[model samples]
Target: MITENQIHSLAKRWEIDQITVMREYLQILFLFYLYAQRKSDKIFFKGGTAIRFLFGSFRFSEDLDFTGTLESDEIIGLFNNACSDLNREIPAVEMENFKKKRNSIVSRIRYTPKPDTYPLGIHLEISIRERPITKAASHIETLLPVSPYPVVTHLESEEIMAEKIRALLKRAKGRDLFDLWYLLTKEVKLNWDMVKKKMEFYNDAATLTDLVSAVKAFNQKKLFDDLAKFLPRAQRKTIPGLKENILEKLGRFAVT
Candidate 1:
C-alpha cells in the first residue's frame, strides 16, 4: 500500500514527483543497491532515474535499475546490504533468501524494500550498473524536475544514479536500438555493455532484442542525422556490434 503523503514526502527531497521519483528511491535499494554497495567501489543512478530529477513523469516502470563497475559477487552483496538496511529502518521490508539462480531459469531477487504503506499500490525495485571506460563521449547529467508539491530544496543532482530502462525498452525499435529521436540525440551516449552489467531483470536476449528495436527506429527516422547538424555528436557509434547485433531480435509486439 503506497500513500500520497509518504510518496510525496520523500520525492520532495529530490525536487521530483512522489509517483516517479519515490519509486526510484525505493527501487534502487530493494532491487540492486544492497547487492552492489557491499562489494563495488563506486555505484550511482544513471538511466531514467536521472531523468526523473530533471523532467520525469509518473508513468509506472517495469522495475528499477542501478549501475556500477564492480565484480559479480559484489553486486549481489550490494543488493543484500540494501535490503538489510531498509528493513532495519522501516521494519516492514522483509527480505530473506532474496536471491535465486538456475541453469535456464530466471536470476532475480524480488522482494518488498519499502517500509512505508502509501496506499498508492506502488512496489519498489532497483537495478545496478558500473560505467565502462572506452574511447567514447562523456556521459551528461541533466537536471530533473519536481512535482507541483514543494519539498525542502530545489531540484539538484542525485546522490545516486539510476534510469528508466523500462521506458527505453518500450521505445525500442528493431531490437535494442532505442528511440534516438525521443532523447533528441542528447550529447551523452549510453554504454550498452556497462549498462548490461547493472540490468538484472531482463535476460541478455531480452535486453539485446529491445535495444535492437530502439536503434533501428532512430536510424529509420534519421534522428541521428538531424541531431548531428546541431550537437557535436559526441556519442558516435561507441557500442561495438550494437548496430547489427541487437537489430536481429524481433520486438515482443511483432505479432508473428
Candidate 2:
C-alpha cells in the first residue's frame, strides 16, 4: 500500500479529495484481482467509473458497476477472494454487508487506512443478467502501481454511451446527463441501434421524439440534487444550462 503522504500528493495532483483517491486505489486493487483471476473476460466494466478511469472524465463515481455472465455465488466468491487480496495490500480494508439482490450482487467496500479515522466506502453493484453485446476491450490500469499492470476489460465507448442514454431515459439522473454531455464533448457517438435494443428490454420505445421529450422534461433541481455529490465543485456551475447544451449536441448527432 502507498503511504499516506503519497496518497495525499496524488489527491493534490488530481485536484480531488484524498479519500476519493484512496477509494479509487481500492477500485484499482479489485480490478487487479479480477485481471489476475482471469475473470475480467467474463465481466464487462461500464458506468461512470469506467468513464472516469477509461476516458478521463472529470467527474468521479461512488459505485463500481459491472454486467456479466457470472452467477451470484461465483461473484460472491470472486469478491471474497478480492477482499482477501485487498486485505493483503491494505490491512484496514474490509468487505461487509454483502447481499444478493435479484440478479445483482451488491456489497459495501470500506477502507480505513488507520484507527479512529473515517472510512471510505464504495458500493459494488454487479449485474449478472447478460453478457456484453460487443467484444470486450482492455485498458491498462494506470492509477496505481500494480505489478504487471492489470488489463481491465470493458465495453466499447459507443456501447457505454448507449447504456448511458438508456439510463437517462429510464432513470433521468443528473450524472447520466452529465456523462452524456461529457461523452459528446469527447465526440463519442451513440449507437442508436444498441440504444433501441436496451430500451426494448424494458419494453420501452426509443425514438428521437421520446429522447427529446425526456431531455426537455428533466427536472433541473433533481438533476443537481442527484449530481451534487458526484460532480467536482467547478463543474457544478455548468448544470444550469446543461439541458440546452445536451439538446444542441443531440440535434447535430441525431440527424439521420
Candidate 3:
C-alpha cells in the first residue's frame, strides 16, 4: 500500500530497483496480513526469503516457504482470506493463477501489486513431511515501511543452517550457497545432529569431503547467473569466491 514516491525512495535507500522494492513490499504486506489472522505461529517460515526478511540476508528471494502443521485446506483458506483483505486495502493488487497439486502438498499464486506493471509472482510451499526440529521463534520484522512490525514464526539459526546445508548438498543453488556463506560469516552455529537427521531424509550420506567436493564443483557462471539479479551490483563480485569462503569457514563445524 505504499505510494509510488515511497517505493522510489525505498529503492534509493535499499540500492535496488523499484520493481524489487515493490515485490518485497508486497511480500511483507502479505506476511503482515497472515499475522493479522492470529495463526502466524502455526506455520514455520524458512528458506531464502525468511533469511532475507528475518535474518537480514543481502539477497532477495521470490518465494515464501514454510513447514507447517496446518492442513492444506486451512492454509488455502488463510491465503484466500488474506488475499481478500489485501485487495480491499490496496485495490490494485490482484491474486491470480492459484493451483495446488493433489499430491505435492504445495500451493502457488501470483500477486500483481499494480495493474499494467510487473506482477509480483509468489510461490508458497508448505511441507508436512516431518515436524520441525526446533521450536518456532518469534522474529519482529520491521525493515520495510509497508506495514507495522509483524512478528514471524520461524526456525532457530542452527536449524536453519542445517536445512541450508542439506539444500546446498542436494541442489547446490547459488542462493543456498550464498545463504550458508552469510550464516557462516555471522558465526551461526550448526547443529550437526540436526543436520544429520535432515540428511537422513534425503538418504544423503555426504561427508565433509563430499561437501567440499560439492562446493568445488559449483559452476561460477551458474552461480553468478542465479544470484546476480537478487544482489546489488557491488555484491555480485562476491559470487566468484563464495565456494572458497564457504569451505574455509565450513571446517569449524567438523565433528572430529
Candidate 4:
C-alpha cells in the first residue's frame, strides 16, 4: 500500500506532479463510465479511450480516438442521444480536433463543463472497423472477452498496461516528450516484462525500432539520469526484469 506520507515523499523527492495528475484522471474515468452504459441502436466503435479508462494513464487525455463499428452510417451518429440521456447542457458539440487520420478513425467530442475545480469534457470517437489484434503473447493474461465488443479485451492486469505504456513513452519520446514523462512518472509499474512482451505481441518490429529511437532521445536529454536519482523505493522493488536490462538497452540506444 502506498501511504500518503510515501506519496508525499515520492512527489517531493522525485519532483514530479504525479498525484495532481491522478486527481484529474478520476474525472476521465467518470466520463468513460457514462458511455459504457450506452444502449443506443447505432453500433458505436469503442477502443482507445475505453482501454485508457480500463488500463492506461492517470491524467487527462487530449486526443480521444474511436472507430465506428461494422454497421454504422454518418448522417446521424449516437452523439446527441447519449448526451441527452446524460442531461448535458448542450445535447452535443462537434469538433475537428484530430491531427490526422489513418484507417477510418472518427473523433467526436463535446465539453460539458462541470461546476468543479477541473472542467469535465466528453469525447467520443468511432472507428468503422476493428483494430487488427496482434497475436496474444503467452505473458498476457486474457480475461473473458466483453460480449458487446469481442475485439476489446481488458488487459489481464494493470501491470500489463504499465509496461506497454513505458515502452511507448520511449518510442514516443521527444515527438511528444510531455506524454512520455507523464506515463513514466505517474503510472504504477507492476510487471514491466509482461507489458514489454504484450507490446511485442502487438507489433514487435515497430516497438523495438521505436524503443531505440525514444531511448536515444531520452539519453540525449539525460532523462533516465533524473529518474534513477529519484525513483521511489516501492517502484524500485516492483520493476523486476527491466532493471539492468532496460538501463543497458537505454545506454546502447543512447544518443551521443
Q: Provide backbone clash counts, one per model.
A: 69, 0, 0, 8
Per-residue accuracy of model 3 over 1-256 as CA lDDT, tens digit each: 5788987887777778887887787777777787678665877888888888877888987888877677777776777777778778766665554466533255544555446766567777776665788765665565567546767788888888888888888888989889989998888886677888889876766666777788889899989899888897678888888889998898776542
Worst 10 residues of 1 by lDDT: 153-162
> Which runs in model 2 stand beyond 4 Å of their true positions?
141-143
lDDT of 4: 0.37
With candidate 4 superimposed using the best TM-score fit, by how many Å does residue 198's alpha carbon deviate from the native?
Answer: 11
After TM-score superposition, the amount by which residue 246's alpha carbon in candidate 4 deviates from its true location, in angstroms, is 6.1
lDDT preference between candidates 2 and 3, better one? 2
State the TM-score for model 1.
Answer: 0.39
The TM-score measured for candidate 3 stands at 0.90
Each model's lDDT = 0.37, 0.80, 0.77, 0.37
Q: How well is each residue in 22-87 modelled by candidate 2, as lDDT tens digits?
A: 787778777778656756577788899989878888887788888877777777787778888878
What is the RMSD, in Å, between candidate 4 and the native fold over all Cα?
10.6
Model 1 misplaced regions, further than 4 Å:
1-22, 28-39, 42-46, 53-62, 67-69, 96-131, 134-182, 189-256
Best by lDDT: 2
Q: What is the alpha-carbon lDDT of model 2 when measured against the actual structure? A: 0.80
